[model samples]
Target: MPPRNAARLYPLVLLLLAFVAFPLYWMASTSLKPQTEVFRVPPTFVPETWTLRHYVELFWLTDFGLLFVNSLKVCLVSTGLALVVGSLGAYALARFRVRGKEAYGRLVLLAYMFPGALLVIPLLLLFRQLGLTNSHLGLSLAYLTFAVPFVMWVMRDFFASVPVDLEEAALIDGASRLGALWDVVLPQAVPGLIATGIFAFLFAWNEYLFALILISDESLRTLPPGMMRFVSTTDTNWGLIMAASTLATLPMALAFGLIQRYLVTGLGAGGVKG
Candidate 1:
């Protein structure tokens, strides 16, 4: 592209970023503002009076802390499972000469594209039959439906980028197939793993519909559904809501920040090499 064209698009790109970022900024800002300033006349773009009362109430006076912990457990376990299973499945599909390999690849992508809403009812019933409903294990399993497929699809491409020669050399050195995978291929795929793991964790952490439907016990509520409990017919605590929202967003932001250096390269490296 010409310098003139790039200059013309710069403003539009910044505008789009601002549009997306403003809501998050507003949420964080609102969480810090006192209730009095939340709906003040002319609306304060910046808070004049900051307070931590909402955070105090959210943590000390309510079960939000427990809810946050439950979410973390479910998401962490789900992401781990997804990474293990998806990586193995991806490696098989990439390295092995299996029958209907293309069809199986398409099927994995199709599974990922399936609507979560549509799966909710059947999953609920299935969990009940298995006596896993209302439990964190069941919730993690629910997350696996989508997480596994996403990891598998991304990892399949990533594994394709890894040269067969490396694995063959390891094999000739008397390393078993699994040993070669662990010692040779997996290290090269770290970036892809980190990127995919982030996606899996974020999805499981942020999902509300399945959590709400599957988990009836308040103790098991994740952040998104737990946050919703703040609203009621008689009253809605905006300060508390904003505070909870801010807290819930922090983990995902921190996770992304830690792996961001690898994310871009991890996502693109496979494409370049494959």
Candidate 2:
């Protein structure tokens, strides 16, 4: 149940919700609108004649399916790589007696903060030299330059929030260090891992500049750059753009819906000390 004061916050909360959700609702509505109706003066709040023409064109006329597949491939691989490597790095930082661990943690955050613009030229040069340009694996690794550090930073706090006593107790029971981590520590970290993983996934899913610069081939493009195909030098396809955008939003929306129960608590704990 909401606290007494929360009742008074309802108006503000609803206002915020409308502020965020209206664009999404409008986008969906526009995607279903007939092209002629989309440009009508004053516009309709809801479509007069709903149709799937845009969505159909998105697949058959454009290679949105290929773009979607490319995005999914790189993102999933990069996210998995970041999670495994970052979790181990965070575990070491939080649990081991390493010197300057705090400084190292700060450095990770610093790397994450470096503007993508700064790395674009250097990474493009490096990947081209390494012949990683135009490859999904290269793109995935490029994503990692940011994704790994973010995962490490968040997971570090999460690992720190978990009580060391529990790991010690397992050790006292004769579990190996790795075994204790597997049996005890990881179970407690599930929510945090899932929350962090989702955040990392979002990063890769939406990143545009790197994908644009690194991959010159049309077939290799991810959604953000792929969306640009809808806009021509003379005209734009609003319906197809909106339809593609609306469809792109589904995976993230579904992911959040599935795990929102744990998201807040996990984030909160990761930000706090035990």
Candidate 3:
């Protein structure tokens, strides 16, 4: 607010930015460095011998492309399922008088707070029973454990914030409850849907433990665990790993940027409600 305070905060802001960005910078930088220099002492801040060999190896020699596709498939399908199921549940909670609604909502939140590692064993056993183990479907289903609750909570808040009068007017115009939601409420809730969908997508994209435990077939492995193919007890391919990490991060960064305008608008809208 004041020039003196602004000047004092600028340096601190820049320092925080560096702290957040340096790891990403290092990951990108290492991906470009020649293998011999990757582990060299006095680590090169910039690659002297920048090359695309690692990327070439990733696409041409490895199954990285397949892994990428697998990750994409899982993220899209799981996020879609989560959004569909969560939005419906959220709408019910927000719009109707359901008994024990608060208790049910709390349980959903608590389910999300449970550690993923603890769920893996029981999930594996459950999947085995259903013949879902080692399948993409199984992996996507496992992801729902966290994604659905998160989407439900967020969407519930957004749906609650929406004025009921809008949906009432739609209903008076010969619209059914579902029709009111589709025609009236959802249009206003677009920002929340985008934000929640993207969160679900990113969670599935970066998820490792469930993918690793649920899938043993190389073809089914997603990018996170698939990157481990580059490592062995003997040596690790740092360049390849860094390159893959950078590539994996790009789609997420791009998705966030695309929705950033709506996300900001949504945040501002949610800050104060009637």
Candidate 4:
């Protein structure tokens, strides 16, 4: 690139960074500020006086810890189930020449594209009849509808990129299909698995619409729904709200950082030309 073009691109790059980082910076700043200082007209870049009161109040005055635990449990269980089921389904689709395989693959893709907003009411009613409303199990299962299909489709592509000869040789050596998958194919797909796990985890963690409508009890509420309870007609606590937002986003940041290497690997794995 020419120097002039590179200079022109620098402003755009800075703008993107500012757009993404400013909200996080504001949240963190607000979290540290006193409630009175949060909305001061002459906004201070740094807190004039720092306070841990909001964080303390969030934990003790509210059920933030319990809500965090609830969210964590739902995210972990749903992601784990999605990864296991999606991987197996993906492997079968990629390796086995079943009738209607193409149609089945398209069906899986279609499921991912399906709108969740349209199904929320019916899903709630179904869950109510099944005695799963306001339950963690029900929430996890609902998440699986989207997470499983997404993971399966992504993993199918990843598995297809792997050399089939490796699994074939393992099978020829008296290994069972499952054994070959467990011992041979899985190791090669570790990067893809990490990527899929991250995707599933985020979907389960950040899901709001379903969690909001399905859960009613305060104790059963996940972070998203629990956060909503903070807003009321009388008042809004911006400091505490920002603190909660910052805390809610931390796990996702850590998850992405941990899996970033695997994400890059998975993206690049299939691009090598023969």
Candidate 5:
């Protein structure tokens, strides 16, 4: 609290920021470097010859544009689905007094206990039987197997933190239960929702296993798996890889930036029971 202590902390904070920011700075700098500069024995800290050739190539030469679209679509849809379904499930767990409620709650989380590698084969067979393989909707559903459980787990606490009297008041005002949730409760839980949505989005955006296994169609491959096309047995394009990685981070950055204030509040509230 003292001025001297605050001054000591500022340097530590800036040092921490620089440590965190270095990778981003390197990725961006490397992506902008020309091929000649990227592999130079003594690598330049900044690009000697700054260029957008990698990005230009990314859009014009490869299937990157489509991959970007596929990732965006799948992550968005999956996040929305997770939020809706998980919120309802969490609400039920929070509000309902039913037999096996604790068991069911644990079961929801048990889905996440196994590694995706263990489940991919059975999932493949199921997808084949249902003709869900290689479809965005199918992948969206696949993502929910993970995201929904997490959402339910986190949101249970958040929903529990919401006052039941608020919902009772809404009921007296002639609002349906869902109406009360939407009109009264969700507003108070915005921070949690936003935080949960971010986690769901990151899961879908960065997930590779299901995207690779469930989607055989080249056009349908999400970014993580799709970007591997840039690698070959003989060669790897560092610039191309860095460029893709840099671009891949944008949607998440924008999402966080837009909801920066909500993130800390939501994560704190949603993570802890009142």
Candidate 6:
């Protein structure tokens, strides 16, 4: 509150701002700069002349639109499946006296922690056998393995925070267990569910390694892998790459901004014990 304290905090605040905003500002600035201007002797922070060429080329010459749609589909479907299944599993874990509940939760978290790279080979082989290679559904299914456990852990904490007395009262009023969960418990857990959904969506949307290995067709590629195609061995189109990166990042930015409140709440709830 003192002037000296405020002044001391200003440097940290400025550093944080620079760290977060600099990359985004650079991406936008690079996207607008022409190829010659981009690699000019003295690097220019701002574009001397703005052009829509990169955006135009991206849409017209490349499969960027299809990649964007593909990424969106994977993120949405994967997140939806994760949240629905995770929420129910979390509810049961939190509310019911299932045997080895603690062990099960730990096992789920352990499974989630396994690196995607480790599973890629086996997953690819399995997909090949199932004829699911190059398919969005296959990618979505792969995403679920990581998404579900984190969602379950977060939602279980949220559900546990809501007292069982409310559900008991509903049961006394003749509401079924599922009805009570739908009507009473779920409303209280919206923030957690939204937070989990955002995590799942972002994970599925930005995934690159699995998409790279599983998909061979240009049409089936997601944004991250599709963006890589812009960078070839001989030359890299910096402007177009930046533009594509900007486009890919926008949805995640918008999604986080929308559900940030819930995300913060859910994260905090997960840290505390019921």
Of the candidates shown, which would achieve the greatest TM-score relative to the real structure?
A: 2
Candidate 2 colliding pairs: none
The model with the greater lDDT, 3 or 5, is 5
Question: How many times do residue backbones clash in model 1?
Answer: 0
Query: Candidates' lDDT values, in order?
Result: 0.90, 0.91, 0.90, 0.89, 0.92, 0.89
- Candidate 4 colliding pairs: none
Error of 2 at 182 (Å): 2.1
lDDT of 3: 0.90
lDDT score for candidate 2 against the true structure: 0.91
Root-mean-square deviation per candidate? 1.7, 1.6, 1.8, 2.4, 1.6, 1.8
For model 1, residues 203-224, the per-residue Cα lDDT tens digits are 9988989999999998778888
TM-score of each: 0.95, 0.95, 0.95, 0.92, 0.95, 0.94
For candidate 6, give the lDDT. 0.89
Predict model 1's lDDT versus the native. Answer: 0.90
Candidate 3 per-residue lDDT over residues 1-274, each given as its tens digit: 9999999999999999999989999999999998999999989999999998989988998999999999999999999999999999989988999899978876888987789999999999999999999999999999999999988887887888999999999899899999999999999999888888888898999899999999999989999899888999999999999999999999988887888998776655544432
lDDT of 4 by residue, 92-156 (tens): 98889999986897698687566889878999999999999989999999999999988888788
Clashes of 2: 0
- Residue 68's lDDT in candidate 3: 92
lDDT of 3 at 31: 93
Q: How does candidate 2 fare on TM-score?
A: 0.95
Error of 1 at 184 (Å): 0.4
Whose lDDT is greatest here? 5
Range of the 10 consecutive residues with the lowest summed lDDT in candidate 2: 265-274
**Candidate 6: 10-residue stretch with minimal lDDT:** 265-274
